[model samples]
Target: MNASVLAHRSMLAKGASGAACLSFQLNEQTPAIFPMRQVQEVIVLPAQQITPIPNMPSCVLGLTTRRSRVMWLVDLAHMLLSQPLPSNIRNYNVVIIRVAQILQQQNMLVATAHKHVLLGLIVPTMKGVVRFSPDLIQTPKGHFAPGLAPCLRGCVLQQDEMLLVLDAEAIARSPILQSI
Candidate 1:
Protein backbone atom coordinates (compact mmCIF):
# COMPACT_ATOMS: atom_id res chain seq x y z
CA MET A 1 0.00 0.00 0.00
CA ASN A 2 0.96 3.67 -0.40
CA ALA A 3 2.30 5.97 2.32
CA SER A 4 -0.98 7.84 2.83
CA VAL A 5 -2.93 4.62 3.14
CA LEU A 6 -0.40 3.20 5.56
CA ALA A 7 -0.33 6.45 7.48
CA HIS A 8 -4.10 6.43 7.78
CA ARG A 9 -4.04 2.91 9.12
CA SER A 10 -0.95 3.28 11.28
CA MET A 11 -1.55 6.74 12.68
CA LEU A 12 -2.83 6.77 16.24
CA ALA A 13 -6.61 6.98 16.20
CA LYS A 14 -8.67 8.03 19.20
CA GLY A 15 -9.98 5.13 21.22
CA ALA A 16 -12.02 4.75 24.40
CA SER A 17 -10.64 6.79 27.30
CA GLY A 18 -11.97 4.51 30.04
CA ALA A 19 -13.85 7.52 31.48
CA ALA A 20 -10.48 9.14 32.31
CA CYS A 21 -9.62 12.41 30.47
CA LEU A 22 -6.42 13.97 29.13
CA SER A 23 -5.96 17.73 29.23
CA PHE A 24 -3.44 20.56 28.61
CA GLN A 25 -3.33 24.34 28.79
CA LEU A 26 -2.10 26.39 25.82
CA ASN A 27 -1.38 30.06 26.43
CA GLU A 28 -3.32 29.73 29.71
CA GLN A 29 -6.43 30.31 27.66
CA THR A 30 -7.48 27.10 25.91
CA PRO A 31 -7.31 23.54 27.17
CA ALA A 32 -5.88 21.24 24.46
CA ILE A 33 -7.64 17.89 24.46
CA PHE A 34 -5.98 14.59 23.50
CA PRO A 35 -6.65 10.92 24.00
CA MET A 36 -4.78 9.41 26.92
CA ARG A 37 -3.51 6.44 24.90
CA GLN A 38 -1.48 8.40 22.35
CA VAL A 39 0.59 10.26 24.94
CA GLN A 40 3.94 8.53 25.49
CA GLU A 41 5.11 10.59 28.44
CA VAL A 42 5.62 14.06 29.92
CA ILE A 43 9.19 14.91 30.94
CA VAL A 44 11.11 17.77 32.53
CA LEU A 45 14.61 18.40 31.15
CA PRO A 46 17.46 20.53 32.48
CA ALA A 47 17.92 23.83 30.66
CA GLN A 48 21.65 23.25 30.19
CA GLN A 49 21.29 19.90 28.39
CA ILE A 50 19.43 21.52 25.50
CA THR A 51 22.32 22.33 23.15
CA PRO A 52 21.90 25.12 20.66
CA ILE A 53 22.27 24.06 17.02
CA PRO A 54 24.25 26.79 15.32
CA ASN A 55 22.61 28.32 12.22
CA MET A 56 19.33 26.61 13.05
CA PRO A 57 16.07 28.50 12.80
CA SER A 58 14.64 30.25 15.85
CA CYS A 59 11.95 27.61 16.31
CA VAL A 60 14.47 24.78 16.55
CA LEU A 61 15.31 24.75 20.26
CA GLY A 62 17.98 22.07 19.81
CA LEU A 63 18.31 18.44 20.83
CA THR A 64 17.06 16.89 24.05
CA THR A 65 17.71 13.41 25.40
CA ARG A 66 14.68 11.47 26.65
CA ARG A 67 14.52 7.78 27.47
CA SER A 68 18.09 7.52 26.14
CA ARG A 69 17.02 8.85 22.73
CA VAL A 70 18.09 12.25 21.47
CA MET A 71 14.99 14.18 20.40
CA TRP A 72 14.82 17.52 18.69
CA LEU A 73 12.62 19.69 20.92
CA VAL A 74 10.80 22.47 19.15
CA ASP A 75 9.61 25.38 21.25
CA LEU A 76 5.85 25.22 20.65
CA ALA A 77 5.49 28.92 21.41
CA HIS A 78 8.21 29.75 18.92
CA MET A 79 7.06 26.84 16.79
CA LEU A 80 3.46 28.04 16.82
CA LEU A 81 3.58 31.80 17.28
CA SER A 82 5.74 34.38 19.06
CA GLN A 83 3.93 33.97 22.37
CA PRO A 84 6.05 33.89 25.51
CA LEU A 85 6.85 30.47 26.94
CA PRO A 86 5.81 29.52 30.46
CA SER A 87 7.94 31.07 33.25
CA ASN A 88 10.09 28.04 34.12
CA ILE A 89 10.88 27.10 30.50
CA ARG A 90 13.46 24.61 31.74
CA ASN A 91 10.68 22.57 33.30
CA TYR A 92 8.70 22.41 30.05
CA ASN A 93 7.18 19.22 28.65
CA VAL A 94 7.94 17.64 25.27
CA VAL A 95 5.24 15.79 23.30
CA ILE A 96 6.84 12.93 21.33
CA ILE A 97 4.89 11.59 18.34
CA ARG A 98 5.39 8.37 16.36
CA VAL A 99 5.76 8.40 12.58
CA ALA A 100 6.15 5.56 10.03
CA GLN A 101 7.83 5.97 6.66
CA ILE A 102 10.22 4.11 4.39
CA LEU A 103 13.52 5.82 3.88
CA GLN A 104 14.57 6.87 0.41
CA GLN A 105 18.17 6.23 -0.60
CA GLN A 106 19.51 8.06 -3.66
CA ASN A 107 15.91 8.64 -4.85
CA MET A 108 14.76 5.03 -4.46
CA LEU A 109 12.38 3.88 -1.74
CA VAL A 110 13.84 1.46 0.77
CA ALA A 111 12.07 -1.81 1.29
CA THR A 112 10.32 -2.69 4.52
CA ALA A 113 13.38 -4.54 5.73
CA HIS A 114 15.31 -1.28 5.58
CA LYS A 115 12.51 1.10 6.54
CA HIS A 116 12.38 2.75 9.92
CA VAL A 117 9.51 4.16 11.95
CA LEU A 118 10.37 6.70 14.61
CA LEU A 119 9.25 9.42 17.01
CA GLY A 120 9.20 13.10 15.99
CA LEU A 121 8.49 16.39 17.75
CA ILE A 122 8.97 17.79 21.27
CA VAL A 123 6.34 20.32 22.37
CA PRO A 124 6.72 22.21 25.66
CA THR A 125 4.20 21.97 28.51
CA MET A 126 1.67 19.15 28.21
CA LYS A 127 -0.76 20.67 30.77
CA GLY A 128 -2.69 17.38 31.26
CA VAL A 129 -5.15 15.19 29.41
CA VAL A 130 -8.73 15.46 28.06
CA ARG A 131 -10.91 13.33 25.79
CA PHE A 132 -11.21 14.66 22.23
CA SER A 133 -13.94 14.12 19.66
CA PRO A 134 -12.98 13.98 16.00
CA ASP A 135 -16.37 15.31 14.95
CA LEU A 136 -15.80 18.51 16.89
CA ILE A 137 -12.61 19.43 15.00
CA GLN A 138 -12.63 22.20 12.37
CA THR A 139 -9.52 23.06 10.29
CA PRO A 140 -8.65 26.73 9.91
CA LYS A 141 -8.56 28.48 6.56
CA GLY A 142 -7.51 31.72 4.81
CA HIS A 143 -4.94 34.02 6.42
CA PHE A 144 -4.01 32.50 9.76
CA ALA A 145 -2.65 34.40 12.74
CA PRO A 146 1.09 33.85 12.13
CA GLY A 147 2.53 30.36 12.83
CA LEU A 148 -0.74 29.01 14.25
CA ALA A 149 -2.15 27.49 11.05
CA PRO A 150 0.88 25.40 10.09
CA CYS A 151 0.99 23.49 13.36
CA LEU A 152 -2.66 23.62 14.41
CA ARG A 153 -4.94 20.91 13.05
CA GLY A 154 -7.98 22.77 14.36
CA CYS A 155 -9.54 24.35 17.40
CA VAL A 156 -11.97 22.84 19.87
CA LEU A 157 -14.19 25.59 21.18
CA GLN A 158 -14.79 25.40 24.89
CA GLN A 159 -16.83 27.33 27.42
CA ASP A 160 -13.77 29.45 28.06
CA GLU A 161 -11.65 29.59 24.88
CA MET A 162 -10.48 27.52 21.88
CA LEU A 163 -8.12 24.55 22.32
CA LEU A 164 -5.68 24.15 19.45
CA VAL A 165 -5.06 20.53 18.41
CA LEU A 166 -1.67 20.27 16.77
CA ASP A 167 -0.94 18.12 13.74
CA ALA A 168 2.16 16.10 14.62
CA GLU A 169 3.14 15.45 11.01
CA ALA A 170 2.76 19.04 9.93
CA ILE A 171 4.78 20.26 12.89
CA ALA A 172 7.61 17.84 12.02
CA ARG A 173 7.73 18.96 8.41
CA SER A 174 7.31 22.66 9.12
CA PRO A 175 9.87 24.82 7.32
CA ILE A 176 11.07 26.20 10.61
CA LEU A 177 11.92 22.67 11.73
CA GLN A 178 13.41 21.30 8.48
CA SER A 179 15.84 24.19 8.35
CA ILE A 180 17.41 22.92 11.56
Candidate 2:
Protein backbone atom coordinates (compact mmCIF):
# COMPACT_ATOMS: atom_id res chain seq x y z
CA MET A 1 0.00 0.00 0.00
CA ASN A 2 2.77 2.40 0.87
CA ALA A 3 4.56 1.71 -2.40
CA SER A 4 1.35 2.18 -4.33
CA VAL A 5 0.63 5.50 -2.69
CA LEU A 6 4.18 6.57 -3.39
CA ALA A 7 3.88 5.47 -7.00
CA HIS A 8 0.58 7.31 -7.35
CA ARG A 9 2.11 10.38 -5.75
CA SER A 10 5.11 10.16 -8.05
CA MET A 11 2.87 9.76 -11.03
CA LEU A 12 0.88 12.77 -9.94
CA ALA A 13 4.14 14.63 -9.61
CA LYS A 14 5.06 13.56 -13.13
CA GLY A 15 1.78 14.96 -14.49
CA ALA A 16 -0.20 11.76 -14.16
CA SER A 17 -3.81 11.81 -12.98
CA GLY A 18 -6.91 9.87 -13.92
CA ALA A 19 -10.63 10.00 -13.23
CA ALA A 20 -13.60 7.64 -12.99
CA CYS A 21 -17.16 8.86 -13.41
CA LEU A 22 -19.11 7.48 -10.44
CA SER A 23 -22.88 7.79 -10.60
CA PHE A 24 -24.37 8.83 -7.27
CA GLN A 25 -27.67 10.45 -6.26
CA LEU A 26 -28.80 12.87 -3.54
CA ASN A 27 -32.59 12.69 -3.97
CA GLU A 28 -34.42 13.31 -7.29
CA GLN A 29 -31.43 14.96 -8.87
CA THR A 30 -29.54 13.01 -11.49
CA PRO A 31 -26.65 10.81 -10.42
CA ALA A 32 -23.80 13.01 -9.16
CA ILE A 33 -20.46 12.36 -10.85
CA PHE A 34 -17.34 11.16 -9.08
CA PRO A 35 -13.97 10.37 -10.68
CA MET A 36 -11.20 7.82 -9.92
CA ARG A 37 -11.63 4.47 -11.62
CA GLN A 38 -11.54 1.41 -9.40
CA VAL A 39 -15.12 0.17 -9.59
CA GLN A 40 -15.24 -3.45 -10.75
CA GLU A 41 -18.84 -4.69 -10.68
CA VAL A 42 -22.25 -3.37 -9.64
CA ILE A 43 -24.10 -6.06 -7.72
CA VAL A 44 -27.39 -6.22 -5.86
CA LEU A 45 -26.69 -7.08 -2.22
CA PRO A 46 -29.07 -9.47 -0.46
CA ALA A 47 -31.52 -8.08 2.07
CA GLN A 48 -30.33 -10.19 4.98
CA GLN A 49 -30.30 -9.08 8.59
CA ILE A 50 -27.04 -7.48 9.67
CA THR A 51 -25.46 -8.12 13.05
CA PRO A 52 -24.83 -4.63 14.29
CA ILE A 53 -21.51 -4.00 15.98
CA PRO A 54 -21.91 -2.69 19.47
CA ASN A 55 -20.69 0.89 20.04
CA MET A 56 -20.49 1.56 16.33
CA PRO A 57 -21.26 4.92 14.73
CA SER A 58 -24.43 6.02 12.91
CA CYS A 59 -23.10 6.16 9.35
CA VAL A 60 -22.13 2.50 9.47
CA LEU A 61 -25.10 0.40 8.23
CA GLY A 62 -23.63 -2.97 9.28
CA LEU A 63 -22.82 -6.23 7.50
CA THR A 64 -25.02 -7.59 4.70
CA THR A 65 -24.91 -10.52 2.29
CA ARG A 66 -23.33 -10.36 -1.15
CA ARG A 67 -22.63 -13.52 -3.13
CA SER A 68 -23.11 -15.72 -0.09
CA ARG A 69 -20.51 -13.74 1.82
CA VAL A 70 -20.94 -11.10 4.48
CA MET A 71 -19.65 -7.70 3.38
CA TRP A 72 -19.76 -4.36 5.08
CA LEU A 73 -22.34 -1.80 3.85
CA VAL A 74 -21.30 1.79 4.40
CA ASP A 75 -22.88 5.19 3.88
CA LEU A 76 -20.96 6.33 0.80
CA ALA A 77 -21.84 10.02 1.00
CA HIS A 78 -21.40 10.43 4.72
CA MET A 79 -18.16 8.50 4.55
CA LEU A 80 -16.79 10.39 1.57
CA LEU A 81 -17.95 13.80 2.68
CA SER A 82 -20.97 14.93 4.67
CA GLN A 83 -23.17 14.67 1.57
CA PRO A 84 -26.45 13.15 2.64
CA LEU A 85 -27.47 9.76 1.29
CA PRO A 86 -30.54 9.42 -0.90
CA SER A 87 -33.81 9.41 1.05
CA ASN A 88 -35.10 6.36 -0.82
CA ILE A 89 -32.81 3.65 -2.15
CA ARG A 90 -35.02 0.79 -3.30
CA ASN A 91 -31.87 -1.17 -4.07
CA TYR A 92 -28.15 -0.39 -4.23
CA ASN A 93 -25.11 -1.87 -5.90
CA VAL A 94 -22.18 -3.48 -4.15
CA VAL A 95 -19.06 -2.40 -6.04
CA ILE A 96 -16.48 -5.20 -5.80
CA ILE A 97 -12.89 -4.06 -6.28
CA ARG A 98 -9.47 -5.49 -5.59
CA VAL A 99 -6.00 -4.04 -5.31
CA ALA A 100 -4.06 -6.85 -6.90
CA GLN A 101 -0.72 -5.05 -6.81
CA ILE A 102 -1.04 -4.20 -3.16
CA LEU A 103 -2.17 -7.67 -2.31
CA GLN A 104 0.80 -9.17 -4.07
CA GLN A 105 3.30 -6.92 -2.36
CA GLN A 106 1.82 -7.42 1.10
CA ASN A 107 1.59 -11.16 0.63
CA MET A 108 -2.12 -10.89 1.31
CA LEU A 109 -4.15 -13.83 0.18
CA VAL A 110 -5.36 -13.35 -3.36
CA ALA A 111 -8.90 -12.15 -2.84
CA THR A 112 -11.38 -15.02 -2.65
CA ALA A 113 -14.85 -15.72 -1.32
CA HIS A 114 -13.67 -16.88 2.09
CA LYS A 115 -10.98 -14.20 2.58
CA HIS A 116 -11.95 -11.03 0.72
CA VAL A 117 -11.41 -7.30 1.14
CA LEU A 118 -14.30 -5.40 -0.34
CA LEU A 119 -16.14 -2.12 0.13
CA GLY A 120 -19.83 -1.76 -0.63
CA LEU A 121 -21.66 1.54 -1.03
CA ILE A 122 -25.40 2.12 -1.33
CA VAL A 123 -25.77 3.90 -4.68
CA PRO A 124 -28.96 4.59 -6.67
CA THR A 125 -27.59 3.84 -10.12
CA MET A 126 -24.54 2.60 -11.94
CA LYS A 127 -23.41 5.62 -13.92
CA GLY A 128 -21.24 5.06 -16.93
CA VAL A 129 -17.51 5.55 -16.54
CA VAL A 130 -15.80 8.84 -17.41
CA ARG A 131 -12.07 9.49 -17.59
CA PHE A 132 -10.27 12.80 -16.97
CA SER A 133 -6.85 14.33 -16.29
CA PRO A 134 -5.40 15.42 -12.99
CA ASP A 135 -5.11 19.08 -13.90
CA LEU A 136 -8.75 18.93 -14.87
CA ILE A 137 -9.78 18.33 -11.27
CA GLN A 138 -10.43 21.27 -8.94
CA THR A 139 -10.34 21.42 -5.15
CA PRO A 140 -13.46 22.53 -3.36
CA LYS A 141 -13.47 25.87 -1.60
CA GLY A 142 -15.81 27.88 0.67
CA HIS A 143 -18.73 26.79 2.86
CA PHE A 144 -20.10 23.27 2.42
CA ALA A 145 -21.07 20.29 4.52
CA PRO A 146 -18.51 19.79 7.26
CA GLY A 147 -18.37 15.99 7.03
CA LEU A 148 -17.57 16.13 3.31
CA ALA A 149 -14.37 18.13 3.64
CA PRO A 150 -11.94 15.35 4.52
CA CYS A 151 -13.21 12.62 2.24
CA LEU A 152 -13.38 14.72 -0.93
CA ARG A 153 -10.48 13.82 -3.23
CA GLY A 154 -11.18 16.46 -5.87
CA CYS A 155 -13.74 17.78 -8.39
CA VAL A 156 -13.91 16.98 -12.09
CA LEU A 157 -14.75 19.65 -14.65
CA GLN A 158 -16.85 18.24 -17.46
CA GLN A 159 -18.00 20.33 -20.41
CA ASP A 160 -19.33 23.17 -18.24
CA GLU A 161 -20.00 21.52 -14.88
CA MET A 162 -18.25 20.18 -11.76
CA LEU A 163 -18.54 16.81 -10.03
CA LEU A 164 -17.27 15.92 -6.60
CA VAL A 165 -14.66 13.16 -6.52
CA LEU A 166 -14.38 10.90 -3.51
CA ASP A 167 -11.56 8.94 -1.88
CA ALA A 168 -12.77 5.38 -1.60
CA GLU A 169 -10.04 4.50 0.88
CA ALA A 170 -10.96 7.42 3.10
CA ILE A 171 -14.56 6.33 3.10
CA ALA A 172 -13.53 2.75 3.82
CA ARG A 173 -11.47 3.83 6.80
CA SER A 174 -14.06 6.22 8.20
CA PRO A 175 -15.44 5.97 11.72
CA ILE A 176 -18.66 4.91 10.05
CA LEU A 177 -16.83 1.76 8.94
CA GLN A 178 -16.56 0.70 12.57
CA SER A 179 -20.25 -0.15 12.48
CA ILE A 180 -20.00 -2.42 9.48
Candidate 3:
Protein backbone atom coordinates (compact mmCIF):
# COMPACT_ATOMS: atom_id res chain seq x y z
CA MET A 1 0.00 0.00 0.00
CA ASN A 2 1.08 3.62 -0.56
CA ALA A 3 1.21 4.94 2.98
CA SER A 4 1.72 8.59 3.83
CA VAL A 5 3.93 8.16 6.87
CA LEU A 6 4.37 11.89 7.41
CA ALA A 7 0.62 12.21 7.63
CA HIS A 8 0.43 9.34 10.09
CA ARG A 9 3.27 10.73 12.17
CA SER A 10 1.59 14.10 12.47
CA MET A 11 -1.71 12.50 13.37
CA LEU A 12 -0.08 10.50 16.17
CA ALA A 13 1.63 13.54 17.68
CA LYS A 14 -1.23 14.21 20.04
CA GLY A 15 1.37 14.75 22.75
CA ALA A 16 4.93 13.41 22.87
CA SER A 17 4.19 9.73 23.27
CA GLY A 18 2.77 8.21 20.14
CA ALA A 19 4.41 7.26 16.86
CA ALA A 20 2.84 5.66 13.80
CA CYS A 21 4.39 2.37 12.78
CA LEU A 22 4.05 -0.42 10.23
CA SER A 23 3.84 -3.75 12.01
CA PHE A 24 4.82 -7.20 10.80
CA GLN A 25 6.24 -10.47 12.07
CA LEU A 26 9.75 -11.78 11.71
CA ASN A 27 8.45 -15.23 12.49
CA GLU A 28 5.63 -16.88 14.36
CA GLN A 29 7.07 -15.87 17.71
CA THR A 30 8.55 -12.45 16.96
CA PRO A 31 6.42 -9.45 16.09
CA ALA A 32 8.07 -6.21 14.99
CA ILE A 33 7.37 -2.68 13.84
CA PHE A 34 9.14 -0.06 11.74
CA PRO A 35 8.57 3.65 12.14
CA MET A 36 6.13 4.56 9.40
CA ARG A 37 8.27 7.49 8.31
CA GLN A 38 10.99 5.12 7.26
CA VAL A 39 8.77 2.65 5.47
CA GLN A 40 8.15 3.11 1.75
CA GLU A 41 5.61 0.43 1.06
CA VAL A 42 4.37 -3.09 1.78
CA ILE A 43 3.57 -5.73 -0.81
CA VAL A 44 3.00 -9.41 -1.42
CA LEU A 45 5.48 -10.56 -4.05
CA PRO A 46 5.25 -13.79 -5.92
CA ALA A 47 8.20 -16.20 -5.51
CA GLN A 48 8.87 -16.17 -9.25
CA GLN A 49 9.36 -12.40 -9.28
CA ILE A 50 12.74 -12.47 -7.53
CA THR A 51 15.80 -13.41 -9.57
CA PRO A 52 18.28 -14.89 -7.12
CA ILE A 53 21.91 -13.95 -7.37
CA PRO A 54 24.86 -16.28 -6.70
CA ASN A 55 27.47 -16.07 -3.91
CA MET A 56 25.71 -13.49 -1.77
CA PRO A 57 24.77 -13.49 1.91
CA SER A 58 22.15 -16.13 2.61
CA CYS A 59 19.77 -13.43 3.80
CA VAL A 60 19.97 -11.67 0.47
CA LEU A 61 17.10 -13.08 -1.57
CA GLY A 62 18.17 -11.14 -4.67
CA LEU A 63 16.37 -8.37 -6.53
CA THR A 64 12.82 -7.47 -7.54
CA THR A 65 11.01 -4.48 -8.95
CA ARG A 66 8.80 -2.27 -6.87
CA ARG A 67 6.94 0.24 -9.02
CA SER A 68 9.47 -0.51 -11.74
CA ARG A 69 12.38 0.39 -9.45
CA VAL A 70 14.81 -2.42 -8.64
CA MET A 71 15.59 -3.12 -4.99
CA TRP A 72 17.08 -5.95 -2.99
CA LEU A 73 14.87 -8.28 -1.00
CA VAL A 74 16.08 -9.91 2.18
CA ASP A 75 14.75 -12.68 4.35
CA LEU A 76 14.29 -10.77 7.58
CA ALA A 77 14.20 -13.87 9.76
CA HIS A 78 17.33 -15.35 8.23
CA MET A 79 19.08 -12.00 8.28
CA LEU A 80 18.34 -11.36 11.92
CA LEU A 81 17.51 -14.66 13.61
CA SER A 82 19.50 -17.29 11.74
CA GLN A 83 16.21 -18.76 10.61
CA PRO A 84 14.99 -18.89 7.03
CA LEU A 85 11.45 -18.88 5.76
CA PRO A 86 9.72 -22.18 5.08
CA SER A 87 10.58 -23.45 1.62
CA ASN A 88 7.00 -24.10 0.65
CA ILE A 89 5.96 -20.49 0.92
CA ARG A 90 4.55 -19.18 -2.36
CA ASN A 91 4.52 -15.45 -1.75
CA TYR A 92 6.48 -13.10 0.41
CA ASN A 93 5.05 -10.45 2.69
CA VAL A 94 7.51 -7.67 1.98
CA VAL A 95 8.04 -4.41 3.79
CA ILE A 96 9.97 -1.89 1.79
CA ILE A 97 11.86 0.63 3.91
CA ARG A 98 13.57 3.74 2.63
CA VAL A 99 16.15 5.38 4.86
CA ALA A 100 17.58 8.80 4.25
CA GLN A 101 20.42 9.13 6.73
CA ILE A 102 23.55 11.13 7.37
CA LEU A 103 26.53 8.82 7.69
CA GLN A 104 29.88 9.84 9.14
CA GLN A 105 33.02 8.64 7.40
CA GLN A 106 36.70 9.29 8.04
CA ASN A 107 39.69 9.27 5.79
CA MET A 108 42.44 11.82 6.35
CA LEU A 109 39.56 13.89 7.65
CA VAL A 110 36.11 13.21 9.04
CA ALA A 111 33.11 13.94 6.88
CA THR A 112 29.39 13.33 6.76
CA ALA A 113 27.23 12.33 3.84
CA HIS A 114 23.64 11.57 3.11
CA LYS A 115 22.45 8.29 1.66
CA HIS A 116 19.04 7.15 0.50
CA VAL A 117 18.57 3.42 0.40
CA LEU A 118 15.59 1.22 -0.25
CA LEU A 119 15.35 -2.38 0.87
CA GLY A 120 12.58 -4.93 0.85
CA LEU A 121 12.33 -7.11 3.94
CA ILE A 122 10.36 -10.27 3.42
CA VAL A 123 8.60 -11.28 6.61
CA PRO A 124 6.54 -14.35 7.32
CA THR A 125 3.44 -12.31 8.11
CA MET A 126 2.52 -8.73 7.37
CA LYS A 127 0.23 -7.05 9.83
CA GLY A 128 -1.39 -3.65 9.37
CA VAL A 129 -0.08 -0.40 10.81
CA VAL A 130 -0.38 0.33 14.52
CA ARG A 131 0.23 3.26 16.83
CA PHE A 132 1.64 3.12 20.35
CA SER A 133 3.06 5.60 22.77
CA PRO A 134 6.81 6.04 22.54
CA ASP A 135 6.97 5.99 26.34
CA LEU A 136 6.08 2.31 26.30
CA ILE A 137 9.13 1.28 24.26
CA GLN A 138 11.62 -0.52 26.48
CA THR A 139 15.32 -1.12 26.10
CA PRO A 140 16.39 -4.38 24.57
CA LYS A 141 18.18 -6.20 27.31
CA GLY A 142 19.70 -9.61 26.64
CA HIS A 143 16.28 -11.25 26.72
CA PHE A 144 15.89 -11.40 22.94
CA ALA A 145 17.66 -13.83 20.63
CA PRO A 146 21.37 -13.01 20.40
CA GLY A 147 21.29 -12.36 16.70
CA LEU A 148 18.69 -9.60 17.10
CA ALA A 149 20.74 -7.34 19.36
CA PRO A 150 22.44 -5.06 16.88
CA CYS A 151 19.47 -3.94 14.80
CA LEU A 152 17.01 -3.52 17.64
CA ARG A 153 15.93 -0.02 18.56
CA GLY A 154 13.85 -1.24 21.51
CA CYS A 155 10.79 -3.28 22.44
CA VAL A 156 7.26 -2.27 23.34
CA LEU A 157 4.67 -4.24 25.28
CA GLN A 158 1.47 -3.46 23.40
CA GLN A 159 -1.34 -5.14 25.23
CA ASP A 160 0.06 -8.70 25.48
CA GLU A 161 2.34 -8.61 22.45
CA MET A 162 6.01 -7.64 22.56
CA LEU A 163 6.52 -5.51 19.49
CA LEU A 164 10.10 -5.03 18.42
CA VAL A 165 10.99 -1.56 17.19
CA LEU A 166 13.72 -1.97 14.62
CA ASP A 167 16.35 0.49 13.42
CA ALA A 168 15.63 1.16 9.76
CA GLU A 169 18.83 3.09 9.15
CA ALA A 170 20.91 0.35 10.72
CA ILE A 171 19.28 -2.23 8.52
CA ALA A 172 19.74 -0.01 5.48
CA ARG A 173 23.40 0.46 6.20
CA SER A 174 24.10 -3.10 7.23
CA PRO A 175 27.57 -4.33 6.30
CA ILE A 176 26.04 -7.41 4.74
CA LEU A 177 23.85 -5.28 2.48
CA GLN A 178 26.68 -2.86 1.81
CA SER A 179 29.11 -5.61 0.81
CA ILE A 180 28.03 -5.37 -2.79
Clashes of each: 6, 4, 1
The local lDDT score (0 to 100) that residue 83 gets in candidate 2 is 55
Give lDDT for model 3: 0.80
TM-score, model 2 to reference: 0.62
RMSD of 1: 8.4
Cα TM-score per model: 0.67, 0.62, 0.81
Off by over 4 Å in 1: 1-22, 34-38, 84-88, 105-124, 139-143
Q: Which portions of model 2 miss their true places by more than 4 Å?
A: 1-20, 26-36, 46-55, 78-89, 97-116
Tens digits of per-residue lDDT for model 3 on 3-100?
45444444554433577898888889899999898888888999999989999899999998877778899998998898999878889998898866
lDDT winner between 1 and 2, please give it: 1
Candidate 2 residue-wise lDDT, 90-133, digit = tens: 55555654322223436664433354357667665565565555
| Model 1 agreement with the true structure over 1-180: per-residue lDDT tens digits | 356533432332344322223456545554564444445556666667787788777666677676677777666665666665654655556666544344668999755645323333344446555544465566643465577676666765433456666665565666676555
> Could you tell me which residue pairs clash in candidate 3?
17-134
Worst 10 residues of 3 by lDDT: 1-10
TM-score of model 3 (CA atoms): 0.81
Better of 1 and 3 by TM-score: 3
